[model samples]
Target: MANFIKPYNDDPFVGHLATPITSSAVTRAILQNLPAYRFGLTPLLRGLEIGLAHGYFFIGPFAKLGPLRDSDVGLLAGFMSTIGFIVILTIGLTIYGAATFGQEKSSGNPNDLQTKKAWDEFKGGFFVGACGSAGFAFICLSSIPTFTV
Candidate 1:
């Protein structure tokens, strides 16, 4: 029927073909709708993405090192690295957030709402980023054959 064909007929590629071989509409529809960030999901998701990427790149060379060559030692390194990363990021973000958002109306007053909010956001992002990186790094490192093997 004309109605059935109209949808395909409207498409440039499909119109020229006897049958619609591929459906661009389906792809277009999916591309249009994506998940929106609500609450603090953005930082968490970003951290995971960044951490995975970091892990992917980090595992290779580090795994080959002397102490890290052992799976147990490597895992410990990963944990240590994660902890260190988290601490560094926390301190740096806290300082940055405080300086940027914690402008005290009165010179001597130190506590404020904005600074707390900024720190919370940074905390969410970096915590995931560091943990994710370490987890992925360890997983990848474990798979490799060590010198003992």
Candidate 2:
């Protein structure tokens, strides 16, 4: 029998998480599976690329103004709204992921004390901080041109 975590087509009911199982763990797993030469290039990279592109396109120069700024007021408003949404969700998920996985591995797993301590420290490390940061950048960049005109 397949695990409940891995969704299946036959039953078609047990969906994935309301969001994705995204964390540094998923990114780390991909890193471990890849060749050293491909260190920074991965599916995660492509996804980030697409996300940045989408954000850019949404708030791009062309979209913000073309003559009838009145007609585009709604689109501009929505772009800012989603950027805010993604940013807020990113922060919430960061806190939740840190608490959930940090406790699971370090607090009670009977692993080596140093190992657990290191994990406890690293759970809120640089990459995790960067996730929140990227969201912030997106929110800022996505809202920048829209508000000025």
Candidate 3:
């Protein structure tokens, strides 16, 4: 019949072949949509902040004592340890933040659960980072014992 004959363009086989979407493509799409600052630099910045504070705290004591031993190596190690802890903390916090706060679609919708979750994550991250950094510093100090103060 004349009605049964479809146009060539309407034929399924004649259409353009689309690229199949894979799991990797979907993951890339999600990552691309996320805010770079929140997902990437926030953690690193937080770690750097902690490291700077630790360095400042040591400055006074280091200045008071005259260097006789391997202060340079010890200091470098201590700083590196602090930086490492910060990296760990930042990663933990970023993952937590992404899971907890990232689901909210609108700033206008104020939900108490979101607030509580954020608070809990913040406290947890602080403790984890602090404990890790302290433990690392203790190990480094015990091993090196460079500062007289």
Best model per lDDT: 1
Per-prediction CA RMSD (Å):
11.1, 11.5, 15.1
Which residue pairs come into collision in candidate 2?
Answer: none
Give the alpha-carbon lDDT of every model. 0.54, 0.45, 0.47
Q: Candidate 1 or 2, higher lDDT?
A: 1
- Candidate 3 lDDT over 49-130, as tens digits, reads 3444453344224323425235555454554555565556557766776777665553331222244344344444454555
- Per-residue alpha-carbon lDDT of candidate 1 for residues 1-149, written as tens digits (9 for 90 to 100): 44334445466564453233244667556644432222334444544554555545554454455366656676567456556656676678677767776754333212222445534554566566666676766766567675753
TM-score of 2: 0.29
Cα-based lDDT at residue 104, candidate 3: 57
Residues 6-100, candidate 2: write the lDDT tens digits: 44333448553222343346865886654322434433343344344444443333234534345746454545554554456446645755665
Displacement of the residue 38 alpha carbon in candidate 1, Å: 15
- The per-prediction tally of clashing pairs is 0, 0, 0
The number of clashing residue pairs in model 3 is 0
TM for candidate 3 is: 0.30
lDDT of 1 at 77: 70
